[model samples]
Target chain A: MNPLKLVVVTAGLTQPSSTRLLSDRLGEAVTRQLADEGRGVDVHVIELRELAVDIANNFVTGFPSPALNAELEAVTAADALIAVTPIFTASYSGLFKSFFDVVDNTALTGKPVLIAATGGTPRHSLALEHALRPMFAYLRAVVVPTAVYAAAEDWGAADAEGLSGRIARAAGELAELMAGRPATSHATDEVIPFEQQLAALRAQQ
Target chain B: MQFGIFTVGDVTTDPTNGTTPTEYERIKAMVRIALKAEEVGLDVFATGEHHNPPFVPSSPTTMLGYIAARTERLILSTSTTLITTNDPVKIAEDFAMLQHLADGRVDVMMGRGNTGPVYPWFGQDIRQGIPLAIENYALLHELWRKDVVDWKGRFRTPLQGFTSTPRPLDGVPPFVWHGSIRSPEIAEQAAYYGDGFFANNIFWPKEHYMRLIGLYRERYAHYGHGTPEQAIVGLGGQVFMRKNSQDAVREFRPYFDNAPVYGHGPSLEDFTEQTPLTVGSPQQVIDKTLTFREYFGDYQRQLFLMDHAGLPLKTVLEQLDILGEEVVPVLRKEFAKNRPAEVPDAPTHESLLANKPDEVPVEAR
Candidate 1:
């Protein structure tokens, strides 16, 4: 059996960022769950901060640099995606949204995703549902019911256990979905046959 | 085995001298470039189509027709004729007239124009670009081969018993080449019709176009047009040449730095490294161009973009002189070596006419 490929994307600007810490926890929980189920897992982490200029240049030139191309290929071909970003101005950071904007709109269709975010306060935590989850839904990804958001206060000793429990629940839900679906390798050569395309257009006419 | 120049017809300010050409000067410059292409030993001269400010070639047929009246052997063509927005009826009539005027030395590249706002200005939605390309080209295809056209499609007004005047020269419509930078659907369209596919190879890495060209080749064979190697392919190259590589780089760095498409984004060095843009000695340009045969198998046409990015008319002419003199001769000789016997040359009016089967007109049908 082919091993499952999981790509974790995090938009953490600084080293030792709590957003990255949240991503690590989520990734570990998913790996642990899948390993316990006797499945091999391949996890690749994408740090969006490193690709800030490439992302911006892609916007300018209408094409991605080779470095950004690799990241795009990895995300599109993975069996599942773990996307985490820090909330900025009541939504995902500009860098995070720009990355997805450059991705083919149909690439994420029917994909399995677990959405997560980190914010300075719990009041801003709902940005995960109102912002990130909806964006994934627009891409037609099958997002899990449990979205894990970690506020800065939630990283304190008082809420550490709470965060971990939420991470475990979301990870378990994601793993269940990944294990159910066969490992995916999106075929780059797949194309709609010209006859079918013409027939469809004729029907519309 | 055709080498030529394609200009975007932009009126940009020269970065080094801070001088901009008037629209009239730029229009005349494009014509001069076309004439120069023939004077120097080149095959084709293709002009772009643009309707917005900063771009002057909104009327390609008029310019090409004028160039036809001047030149003797050069092929007059469009870098791309818009398939999405322009009425295909107009395209059929215009190019057929150009074919007669140019004595069958005409070909066209069909593309869905990329500017989003230009779509709405022409009463089209950019969102429906692919479908519009499909339906309109289908109509254009039938109008040329058949004497009468009865057409109804989503994007245009219905036509009944329309006869586009001036039937194609010798009843062979101009050869069509589908040009695309990224879309795979365009590749499929080209393959389905057994038309040539032109990859804008200057913009992105090779892998992106590799997959697209591979798919086009596969489907070209699947549709029974020919083997993968026999499918016609064309590529776009951007080069600036001098006797010394350092001087070439020094002269072009400012223009490359401020180019409207990719300037101010990446350094000139990185852009050249990642994409097909080459600013170097004649030998460097020749060596890099030969690698294209390795990448895309055996292509038929190679058109370099040497006139854009605000390079002056004098510099562009000098660059073309070096290219036609030093670079292309070696590329032609080297690319011909070890090449398979099965690959076809770029399609010309005479070849297409010879290959066309005997058929009677409306009286017999």
Candidate 2:
């Protein structure tokens, strides 16, 4: 079996964004789980704050910038994606959302996505289910069943053990999703039309 | 150990030169500041969203998605995602698309937004802001969790067996933080859903944010998500640093007085005294910020408003250097020392998703 490729996307631009920290932890957990499963996996992490120009330009022009083009390529090629954002109001941030507006509609077709968010309190945790999940659903991406939300209190202290366990569980689910390969019956289906099948069979006889 | 800087972008004139940086230049400077934050060892970067003049981050996700490709470790987030104004459906799809682009280092702070007229611009009413926030969020949650949703609400049109696409990365949605400066209703909303509550402690005194955070903590426990102490909280701050305390004050004073946000309203000294804006050496910033725990109790994330006040980009970069080298390290150590063993660190994507309850099967409504 081919190793799964996981990519983590973060919308935190500051040095201490909770979203990014959470995303990195998720990446680490996924990597560890894959390793434990004896399946080699390649992980890619992309931070959206560094690509400000491409994002801004793309929005104005209604087209993908060259830099965004590369990012789109990465998404299309990846096996799964982990996306994290901070909840703003009752939804995802404009910076986090605008990055996706430029991608080709088909880029995320059938891709698996893990959604997560960080907020100051637990109230906005639902933004994942309400705002983020539907967005990906429209894009035709296969979002993971579980969504992780870390309230501000989640990081109030320095307990790596608790945080790591949560990450590992999310990663474990991702591993399971990746491990269950979809059947590829279309490829094996006989190409001959129904009418042609009889003729082909007769000819073979 | 995540760290980064955020720019509340403004197109301000260089007071000395009488020349204003274009919106483009100012926006680019924000990116440079983010890079500098990362270069200096901070972990994440965020920008605010304002649709009006003097504010350049009208489209934050676009900016963050662009930044995603350039840096490796820096997480990109928004100081505000206008949940009150923007359509919830668009919000869901856009961030999910960004999730694919940036990999997974994305999260957002949801706010009702400060601007009044922006509501009409987006075909919404300011009077309906709270209800909009509640209703739209409810629908958004369903869209992310259920593969197909049938939702009918007062604000937006109903959804009949609709499915939002580009399934969230790994089938999990991005984390959410509800940011409120003075609205208890917003805090209540956050607590009701067990989300993070952010008090951007920039303008008001500690007492104001304290009440808000206190309410959130109390209600979080009421909802049975966790203990009040386990309620997630994030705070916002502002600082100006120099090697010498006196120099920091001297350099920052002129900019503070003339800044568009609070200019001519209060003396720079008075404003700093009243608000979380700290002006002095790195030690002063560290000391003032550490005291936040004293007022708000143990908290999860801390963000600084470094790039506001019309400060030049060069000066802002210098601030990041001080923050990375002198300020954050000390605070990190101090925060860790005081943290209790039973307390949990703030949630990240990993920690939040680790413990899973069985999925609730949905029936068509």
Q: After superposition on all CA atoms, what RMSD does each candidate show versus the true structure?
A: 2.5, 27.9
Best of the candidates, DockQ:
1
Give the alpha-carbon lDDT of every model.
0.92, 0.78
User: Model 1 fnat?
Assistant: 0.63
lDDT of 2 by residue, B1-365 (tens): 34556667888876655678888889899888877877887776878889898789898888888888787777777788888888888888888777778877777778888788999999899997876776677667677678898877666777888888877776677777899887887787788778889898887667778988998888788878889888888888889999998998888877877776665455567567667889998888989999998898888888888887667888888888889999998888898885876667766555546754645566633
Number of the top lDDT candidate: 1
* Poorly placed runs, candidate 1 (over 4 Å): A158-161, A201-205, B150-161, B356-365
Superposition TM-score, candidate 2 onto the true structure: 0.62
**DockQ of all predictions against the true structure, Cα-based:** 0.57, 0.01
lDDT of 1 by residue, A76-129 (tens): 898999999999999999999999999889889888999999988889888999
lDDT of 2 at A92: 90
**Residue B116, candidate 2: C-alpha displacement in angstroms:** 1.1
